[model samples]
Target: MTGDGPGVTLAESGEFAVIDRLVAGRRQPPWVPLGPGDDAAVIACPDGRTVVSTDMLVEDRHFRLDWSSPHDVGRKAIAQNAADIEAMGGRATAFVVGFAAPGHTITAHAVDLADGMWHEADLMGAGIVGGDLVSGPQWVVSVTALGDLGGRTPVRRNGARPGDVVALIGDLGRSHAGYELWRNGIEQFDELRRRHLVPHPPYGQGEVAARTGATSMTDVSDGLLADLGHIASASEVSVDVSLDLLAADLDAVAAAGAVVNADVRQWVLGGGEDHALVATFPTDPPPGWRRIGRVLDHPGSQPRVTVDRVPWHGTAGWESFRVD
Candidate 1:
């Protein structure tokens, strides 16, 4: 798309000028001793270690310009990366972004994208520390999230035991439902459609689960079964998710499913990008977490994830190289 009115294009304003506009008038959190405008950023790691994760989003593949605004795309990029840190039982403190777009793109769109990143970062009291901007064939957003563990041990995916309770904190299937709605060109279910554009991960709940003695944890960025399979494989355990426990989630998307002529169960089980935190706990999960399943011994059996003790035969989750 071409620029209009007084808003300049990236090619017109040049890279440095555009970067200045993106960083101006933004406040960084106190933990971020130094923010943008430097060769690198300085963050405080009081616990002597830092949690880091990175994710990249490509235009039209991860998102669509027609389906999502630049701001929404920015938020999605930061949210997904931040969720990874949270899954490690830490709180995100800072983020560094790498943004690339065509020279013909509007500068205001880039500013809007930065605004969305800041908006989500502020939700967890994190700061946008530093980043780079460049010209590319399409919009590409890459974010690196830095987190603090607050003296708690990092919760890994291999710690789950046979008796651990599988629990989750955040909604499931909404983003997938939204994607279907958007794909079908249905304008209804505005909330689901919006959720597909921007995910609302339980930000501080990761540290809460860690404090509650969670054995293992991961964010449901790829479908529930696919992500749970990660925990199962790592812990060398079999995970059986109960459909009875997921009735509410199924019900939540039933209407949208009908509108799109899709299966709500598949959405809840195999759909991804919701970014919900799923964990296995030895004791009762944190207050907001919902119990969905349990871990089992994997003696002589392959590490796998099942629903109600049955193997699921559907699209497991997103794969990077899959050709549809």
Candidate 2:
């Protein structure tokens, strides 16, 4: 209902009501010992190891309501953090969210956002568990996810050996291309644009990699090379990404690159937020993964991310306070 006429803002509907509507009609998985509507949801940790990770999305910084729906933003908040858990070779079990928005925002928007979060959480057989709502200058959503190791050792980022092969799953460069499209007012490539709004991570592949003897892994929240640099730095090894293996991804965005006067390869290698999974394996990687690079002996240079044996010149990765 509107404040004066037909349509009112979120400020009019109220926060509690919005949350109730958002949470209504959602279901959690059987392993979720506790679901939403509680202070915190608990899950069975038979292996006695729990994986936890958190991410924060600030308005304009992480998302724009103009570009994404409340639902889309909510899903993204959960998905990115969950990807962190998956990168550690764990299955997500629950989430706790914190939402900060203006008091005048419509309650319906809040509910819709929560609905989106729940929808995405359901995809991994997890639950929202609990969350907090507060007032703020702009919309701010923070999510922390808890995961179960299922009796397997958690995969860290420092285990790669010199002979380990680097592999990747999920699409690359599409999000960056989409971002370019949106920024430059180029209207072609609807699929790329949609990807900017919602990233599709390869679910369950992390565990598969873990089972297949993956030595190290991390989500590509940062760019492909930038993320791999984390592993390289931690393991004291060098990484060399093969451009040939990434040709298809570059091709996918070549047209978009032309439209925006950008290099598709740069997007493939440097653009982040696709949330793709990249891992290192001692043997052949599992199915659904593509070999992209190899680990090398550490030369004792300051930890760096490189491609073709040299530092990439494109925007390397995302930094919280920097602009592209």
TM-score of each prediction: 0.98, 0.94
Top candidate when judged by TM-score against the true structure: 1
RMSD of 2: 2.3
The number of the candidate with the highest lDDT is 1
For candidate 1, the 10 contiguous residues with the lowest summed lDDT are: 1-10
lDDT of each: 0.93, 0.85
TM-score of 1: 0.98
Tens-digit per-residue lDDT, 1-324, candidate 2: 333223445566555655566566777777677766777667777788788999999999889898899999988898898899889998888898999999777666787798889888888988887788888989999999999888889899989888899999998988888988998887789999988888888878888988999999999998898898899888888888999999889889998999889978889998899989999998998888999988888765775666877888887677787754
**Model 2, residue 315: displacement in angstroms?**
2.2
**TM-score of model number 2:** 0.94
Show model 1 residue runs off by greater than 4 Å. 1-5
- Residue 82 lDDT (model 1): 93
Clashing pairs in 1: none
